[model samples]
Target: MSAAAQRVDTGRAAHGALARQLRLARQGRSMLFPFIGRSRRFEIWAHYPRHDAVDSSGRWQFYFHVHDRAEKDSARHPQEHGHIHLFRRSPQGKLTHFAGLALDARGLPLCWFATNQWVTGERWADAASLVRELAHFELRLRGPLSGAGLWLGDMVRFYATPLRQMLEQRDAALERHCRRHDQTRAQAWADRRVAVWSSLPVNWPQDALSAAGPLTQ
Candidate 1:
C-alpha cells in the first residue's frame, strides 16, 4: 500500500480552487456552466459530462454533469441534477472508476455513490482499493487542469468519512444482488438498468462560501 493509496493531510484551502471555478462559472449562467469557456450554452449541456478537470500525470481526474439519472420505478433515490465521475489511471495504465458525487440542479453535491461498469465503461475496483486511491488523487502540475485536480483531491478529503461509508454500502448492495439473482453473471453488475448501485445523502459543504476567498499576497 503506497502513500498515494492512503489519505494524508492536504495543505490549506488553496485546493478549493475547483469549487471556486465552479462558482464563477455559475455567475451568469446555469448549473456547472462556463465549461472550457462555453460552446453555445446548453447546446452542449448534459453532453456526457465533459472532463474539464484532469491530472497531467493522469493518476487521477474528476468530471461532473447534470441530468435525470435515477431509477425510474423506485422513489428511494430521487434523481437530481447529475453526477461527477472520478477516475484514476494506474501505472499499468488501467482506468479505474472510483466513485461519484451526485449533485443537485443548483450544482450542490447531494450524495456519493458507486456505479456498475456499464454506466461509465470503467474497470471495477473493490471498495477497499478505491478507498486507498482517494488520498493520492492529487494533480500538482501547472496547467489549466491542475486546479481542478487539486480541487477534487480536496473534495475527497473534505468528505472522506461519508464517501467511505457509501462505498461500503455499494459493496454490500452488490453482494445482496448477486445472492438473490445470479452470481455467475459477472456482467450483472454492468447491467444498464442499474446505474447507481448505492448512495448516501451528502450535506453541502459549509466551507464552499469560504472557498471563494480573499487571497492574500
Candidate 2:
C-alpha cells in the first residue's frame, strides 16, 4: 500500500477500535462507574445528552452540543459532541472542579481540556480548594473501554495542573490588563463576582448543571 493508503488504513483501524470502546462505555451492564469511583474520590454521573440541560449560551457555556452533524466533518465539528462533563464539588457546597470528555463520532474520547471558569470567588481559599481536588480527577480506560478513559486520564494529568496555573495567571493578568485598559470597570466586575460568590446560598449544588438547573432555559 502507498503511504497515503497506509495512513488511511491506520486511521480507519483506530476509528473502529474507538467505536467498539464507545459501545462498551454505553453498555448498561458494565460496572465501570463503580470501578472509576475506586480509582478516584468523587461522585461521577454518566448519561446521554439531555435536551433540557442544553445551555442557551450555545456551546460556549457549561453544556455540550454538536455544531456540525456531518459524518466525516471533524474539522468543523462542535467543541464537545459525544462526551460527558465531570463535576467535582467541595464539601463546603462549592463547585471546585470541572472536566469534560471530548469524544469522536464513535463516542470515544479523543482529547481532554480544562477550563478556568470554575474559580470565580475572590477568596483564594475557595479557588485553591477547587484546584486541589481537580488534580486527582482521573479518567481510566481499561480493555475495550480504554479509549475514552485513557484520553480522559491523559487530559486530567496534562491539563489539570496547567489549567489551574493558567487560571491563576489569567486572574493576575486580568487585574493588570484591566488596570491598564479600564481599571474602574474591571474593579467593579471583580467586586461583583466576589460579592456574588460570597453571598451564594449555603446549599448551592455541588455540580454546575444542578446549580444551573434553575437558570437553564
Candidate 3:
C-alpha cells in the first residue's frame, strides 16, 4: 500500500515475468556455462528481459565478479576491495552498459554511484527489501530453469569465503579506521551504522510468494 511496498511489488513482478520467460527460452538447456576452464572465475551470471535495451527479446545478461583472490592479490592498485560487475548485451550481441556494486571494507553496500567507467553502487534496501532478493534471483535461474544451476553453484563456491572475509575485514577496518580517525567517536559511529543496517528490512517477501505460488503461473 505504501510507496516502498509498491516498489518491492514491482520488482517481484518484474522478476517473476523474467523467470517465466527464461524457463521457456531455456527449456531443454542443460548447462548455462558451456565454456570450459575455471567456470568459478565467472560467478553470478543471468539473462533477464529488459525493455531499456536496444534488443526487444531481452537476451541481456549480467555477471558479477564478487572477488578474485588471485587477481586481487596480484593487482597493483586494487581499487576494488570486492565488487559486483553487471554486463548486458543486445540480442544481436552488441555490448551494453556494465555496472558494479561498491561496498565498503565491511561489505555493506554504499550509495549507487559510477566508477572505473562503469556504474557502481549499493543495492537499494528500500526498494529491494532483502539482500537475498539478489541472491534468489540468481538462484531461481539455476533452479526451475535447469542448466543454469552451475551459475548458482559457481557463485556459492567463489563468493562464499571471500564475501565472508570481506565483511569481516571491512568491519575490522572500520573499527580500526574509526579508532584512528577518532577513538572517542569510533564506537558510537560503528554502533549507529550497525543499528541502521540491522533495522533495514532484510527479508524478502518469501511468505507472500510461498502463499501465492510461483509468480510466473
Candidate 4:
C-alpha cells in the first residue's frame, strides 16, 4: 500500500479506538469515572489511581491529577478539571515527559500542551526527538483503568499531526523566551516563570469526524 494510504488507515484506527473507549466509559458515568474510581474527593496534586498507570514493561505511563485552585494560572487554563501527564521510560529507567492533555469536568479533552523541564521534572528532550518518540506511546495494561490508558494512547495517535506542531511551537516559544530573558535555553528551561511553554486547543469529537475523511494536514 502507499504511504498516504497507510497514514489514512492509521488515523482512522486511532479515531475508532478512541471513540469506542469514550462510548464504553460513558455508559455508566463520565469518562473520568474509571480513573477516579469511587473517590469522593480528588485532592489537588494527588495522583489518581494513587499510582500512575505503567505498562507491563514499564515503558509507557501516565497519571491524572488536579492542580490546586490557587496554583492554577487561570489566564492560561481557566476551565481545566485536571490534566494527564504522559511519559515514556528511557533506557536508563528515567521517565521522560513527552506531552500532556488537559481535560474539562466531563473528561473531554481540552488541549494539548508541552511544558518546561521544571514543570514535570522530566529528562529533557528536544521537540524533534519527542515528536519522533511519540509514535511509540501505546499503553498496554490490564483491568478497569486499562481502557483509560488505551484511550490516552489513541488520543495521542489521533492527534499526532497537531501534537507534533504543538511540540514545534514549544521549541520556538522556548527560543523566544530565552532570547527575551537574555538567558541560555537551558536556563530558561528551568525557569518557573515558563511553566506551560506552548498549547493548542483540541476538540476531539470534531477531530474524530475529520479523521474519518482525510488525515489532518
Instruction: Say which candidate scores most in lDDT.
Output: 4
> Which window of 10 residues has the lowest lDDT sum in candidate 4?
208-217
List candidate 2 stretches off by more than 4 Å. Answer: 1-83, 108-127, 138-155, 158-161, 169-173, 180-217
Give one digit per residue, the lDDT tens place, for model 4 in 1-217. Answer: 4669648755765666566555766576666777786678878888877888887778877888888877648435677888988887876778788788888887777888887888888988788887886565577789878778777777777777778898999889988988888999779978887788888898766767666663332
Per-residue lDDT tens digits for candidate 1, residues 103-135, read 666555667777877777777888898777655
Which candidate do you rate higher for lDDT, 2 or 3?
2
- For candidate 2, the 10 contiguous residues with the lowest summed lDDT are 196-205
Clashing residue pairs, backbone N/CA/C < 3 A, model 2: none
Model 3 scores a C-alpha lDDT of 0.33
* Cα-based lDDT for every prediction: 0.60, 0.37, 0.33, 0.77
Q: After superposition, how far is residue 184 of candidate 4 from its true place, in Å?
A: 1.9
Cα lDDT of model 2 overall? 0.37
Instruction: Name the lDDT value of residue 177 in candidate 2.
Output: 49
Q: Flag the better candidate by TM-score, 1 or 4.
A: 4
Off by over 4 Å in 4: 1-3, 72-75, 213-217
Root mean square deviation (Cα) for candidate 4: 3.6
Give lDDT: candidate 2, residue 207: 22
Estimate, for each residue in 1-217, the C-alpha lDDT of model 3 and write its tens digit.
Answer: 4656545544554454334334534654222222212244444322121112121234334443344546423321234344433334445565432223443343333322212211222221121122222332333233222333233333322232233343344345445656665654334343433321111111122423442345554
**Model with the higher lDDT, candidate 3 or 4:** 4
Which portions of model 1 show Cα errors greater than 4 Å?
Answer: 1-31, 34-37, 41-53, 68-79, 91-93, 141-145, 207-217
Supply every candidate's count of residue pairs whose N, Cα or C atoms clash at under 3 angstroms. 1, 0, 4, 0
TM-scores of all candidate predictions against the true structure: 0.71, 0.35, 0.27, 0.87
What is the Å distance of residue 38 in model 2 from its true position? 24
* Rank by TM-score (best first): 4, 1, 2, 3
